[model samples]
Target: MKNITFCDQYGQLGGGQQVLLELVKAALENRFTVQVLIPEGPCADKLETLGVEVRRISNCALTQGKKSVLDVMRFAMYNLSVFFNNFSVLRSADLIYVNGNRLLPVAFFAQRILGKEAACHIHLNHGKLEKKLFRIFLRQRRTSAIVVPSAFIQRELVHFDTAFDSPKVRIVENGLDARFTSTAFEDRFSSRPLRHVGIVGRVSPEKGQDVLPALARRFPDMDFHVMGDAAFSSADFYATLRRDSPANVHFHGWVEDLPQKVREIGLQICLVPSRCPESTPGHSFEAAPLVPMQMAALSCLVMVRRLGALEDIAKSLQLISFDSDEELIPMIESLRVQPAGEPLALCENSHKLAVSRYSHNSFHENLKGLLRALIPV
Candidate 1:
């Protein structure tokens, strides 16, 4: 049996972590001896429950530009510890799959020693330094491929490193769960005042969810709901937002049954307001978001920041896209005044397009192909 080990830096259930679950699930289904190295948290528990061997590695939270000598030594020592801890399992595996850009260095070190087949599955945006490092690692020994979920990200990476060719990079779009595919489209306009607009995902500064309160204050008629909590970071960000949130705005931490929760909360419009790359390319929020696209597939008149990853999908589905808070308010006003039929039709069309674009079968096939390329059958 081919032993494939997947490493995820974070332990919580976020978009990237969710994709890792799907990847692990696919490997199990294909009869591969799958192992996962992750921070001991909910994700590891879930993997353990599913009978996958999970090795817990303590997470070294990003030391955002702490340049002091002592701080740098601590960061380096922490990484070295993580590397040493996982080195044995990593060496034994036929293939090591690294998830996210930051964790690349860890796997790179292992590959250097073992020269084992390795590939990276990227789900978030990388900056100049990360891009430079990724290129450096990509060209190193035992590095086989780079899997990205969108053409936009592929372009961003290749453009970031012009000398690096595209042949090794694999484009694997995130797929919609089959359970959510058949669900009916939402009729957002039916509400007399057009209530219950929502933003869902792991709450973070980058996600731009704090803007929900200001939005709720602007449109008193709308009951704006923020339906996710801080995953990696502290709850302080969320606690502050909740304490200060206007009456119309609500914060519901991590919904279990997402589709049912969206329906129960009467969430008519879904918002993707992440603000990392300010204007040009879409941020990681657009990097195959699970919540927003599922809402789109369910026909919720999904609105995305025109600059984010979801913009291309929104445009393809002919759904609405907004750049700023100024642009968003007017669109919300239009939903309040416009007849329900127009948006309902658009939601249905978007759902149809999304179902075709992201499907379980395709994602499974793509993941299998990526793995096979590393360790041939």
Candidate 2:
């Protein structure tokens, strides 16, 4: 079999990017001769440092500068670049993996253009317009399979395109490193304040961070920390959250060692209040539910809005949930009375789910099985 190749837009630290990187790392470790193509710069540099073969593409104009006609032109140019870049890689690979529905255009085009076996992983769930556009995108391709992170997404894809079935659409749960299951949370840091409630993800409007101010006012005694850098969609919204917040609301910009930091600060609980149907680039509910399990590995409790795929995971893991602030308030307040016990067992079980069900290992295995049925033996 030809080795697999992975492609993503950038190395910006987030769930989708994180999953791709982790999978890339694991693929390399498994001696699969893995290669990752990324829009050039720091992300490419980081991957090179990790000893993975990196192909830096000049496509994708991502900058702190404001948007303009030239920027749009540049973005279009990058899409062309993405097409050619992946087109070149397709020739040498047995399988191509594309993360996120946004990049489906490039992968789908490659498969149709080059007759390569490519997989488009759907990491986000959408409503109407998004579903329509995605279905249109999928219709254009006569390629490989469609991978979804949750059954929620699987159902949504089928709704948009009724022909979606086992060969095309498959479900994979988001996975966590099993080692995180053994990492312990320590309370040695004095900087760790009481009732520290953290919300992590790109600081954006869709995340529904605007409610933090009201939440802070509701529970002045507890500290609310928002950890994530802003994307264009949510930058202004994030500014408003900062401008109109109480002292209890704190913002920590992107940190490289996030999982470690979450452990260091004794992140007793993590909250994700997403306004969208609960999505971040990769996996369901922005894959924040995994945080609770990671925290559960360390015995930290996760209290999240009953959004996205989290509702299912929360029910499976028995994590906490609330509808409105009225109900959410009491749950937050109750945490002040007690911190959760060691959640190692729950964390281990959750990690196992990631590997057995969500990891690329499982994804590829399913892909192989599907191909066997689709192609002549």
Candidate 3:
């Protein structure tokens, strides 16, 4: 099969992009010819490094950010550029994998013009209106399926538009590369004493870093280490976090060696304290597989705020759950006092659940089946 995956540059190398890359890599491994359409950045470089063809497309202005005259000019230029460039590729693709929210219109137009299969894979939780209109606009077109990472998102889509009862809708929970988890699970601890609690992914308001100071003050004995960069849109928010933060909080700008960083800090726990509800959080979404199974992998207990997909993943993994700091206090204290819990077998069970359900191999098989159904032999 010949495929084209669409994405934006805003997220750069964000989690959604990582998930897109995983699918593309799998497609290549399965001997399916693939091309990726995206705004140029680090992700393009990474994809190129992996031997996948990359095509830079101009983004519509209104779709990108806040409205202004400058944005309007840029939008006009972007649309013109995209309209002309997309011609050759859209005519060539057997399938167009739409990865971003705004890229829907382009993919819709492409499929209508070329009579190819289009798949809309929603990454985050979308609002009511967005979901309602998207279903109405794309359902009867060349769209073969609508995919989401969690059941919460699937429910949200159907809630917005009851017409989504069609068999075309699918829930493919995000998966992790099993090999990556293996590396982390084996090096969970070292000779050094555990001193810090680690939080991974981009630092933004939605991520709940604003509440970090409060969490830090409550737990003075342990350090809070944030492992990611600030979004350009949320730079001021990140600045406030840095300026007002206490000495106990350490912000490591950006690190490529995530598993090694977890090893170096001898991190005993990974806390995901998100303030807002995520549609499908990539950091926690993808990490869910590792949290449960990699006991020998990381010896770390995962703590998450009771919101979005984390709630589902935590329940599935059988990990401990807490909603507020008051509740979290006891949970953290319990872990501090006891080193003995259930056997590593429990962790292994969680691992098996994660790998079997969310592994890349499983995702590839599922996607291939969907593609074949969309474009009949």
Candidate 4:
């Protein structure tokens, strides 16, 4: 079996780390000897549970929102240590897969010095400087593939540098498990009046969790639930949210089984109030967020902000999209008073699209094919 080493910067179970776990499982199913190099956290534990080799590394101490000059210097210093520490593991693998953009510097060094072939999977639409820096490493001969989860990210890259418009760039959308899609339609659809609304993701400024208090105050009768924790650099935001939120707003911190918890809360509507990149330059925007598809599969009506890949996914799934924070109130009011059948029809259609277009089986096959092709014969 060919060996494949996957490198990731974060140890937390965020969206990108979740995707990395799925990719590791796919590699194992294809009979590839899989090994992961990541920081010590839940992600490494999950990989170990799956019977894959896991190596712990120092955390990449990059700032989450806006990076300062010191943040850049610290990350540069961390990259040097990463290069020396993980060199052996990277050299032994037939294919080196860098799962996040922050890990690209080490991947570039490995490809240049060790003559190894590497693939970089970028999950977010980065800012101008980051995009330019990425182009330098991605343009190298040893960087075999530039994998992005959505066409929006591909467009973002190409818009910045036309050189990214090459065959090496590939779009592989994130997928949901079949169990979510297999949830019975009638079980999820209810004629009862919808009262519960949920916002699922990390509690951060860009995630727009700050807007939830205003929404809670606007709709007193409706309960708003936040189904995630203040991971990374959002503890202050979380504290502020707790202080300002009305009685109708609830915070369910870091759920272990998110899908089941979502069902238990009986969420009728899910919101993706992510901030647009036009307003915040350095902050990362959502690129193919798995929450919308997950909620759609569970038959919850999804409404998203018209930003990045969210707009594309919303258009494809026929979900609602609002351009601003003010627009959400009116949109939610409309959905609240609309005919039950109308919302049910939309949810049913979205569920069907999620099943047919973004199933886990299809994701595994496509990722497996990519890994197989990248490995030398």
lDDT of model number 4: 0.84
| Candidate 2 TM-score to native | 0.77
Candidate with best lDDT: 4
Q: lDDT per residue, candidate 4, 26-144, as tens digits?
A: 78877899889899988889889999889998887766556899999988888878888878888888778999878778887788888888898988887877788778877888888
* Ranked by TM-score, top first: 4, 1, 3, 2
Best by TM-score: 4
Task: Report lDDT (Cα) of residue 305, candidate 1.
Answer: 73
lDDT by candidate, in order shown: 0.76, 0.61, 0.63, 0.84
Runs off by more than 4 Å, candidate 3: 1-5, 8-11, 58-81, 184-194, 277-298, 340-357, 375-377
Per-residue lDDT tens digits for candidate 2, residues 194-221, read 4667877778766667768988998888
Answer with 2 or 4, whichever has the higher lDDT. Answer: 4
lDDT-best of 2 and 3: 3
What stretches of model 4 exceed 4 Å from their correct place?
A: 186-189, 277-284
User: Which candidate, 3 or 4, has the higher TM-score?
Assistant: 4
Per model, state how many residue pairs clash: 1, 1, 6, 0
Model 3 collision count: 6
Q: What is the TM-score of each candidate against the true structure?
A: 0.92, 0.77, 0.83, 0.95
Cα deviation in Å at residue 147, candidate 4? Answer: 0.4
Tell me which of candidates 1 and 4 scores higher on lDDT: 4
Q: Please identify model 1 stretches exceeding 4 Å from their true place.
A: 64-75, 186-188, 191-193, 277-285
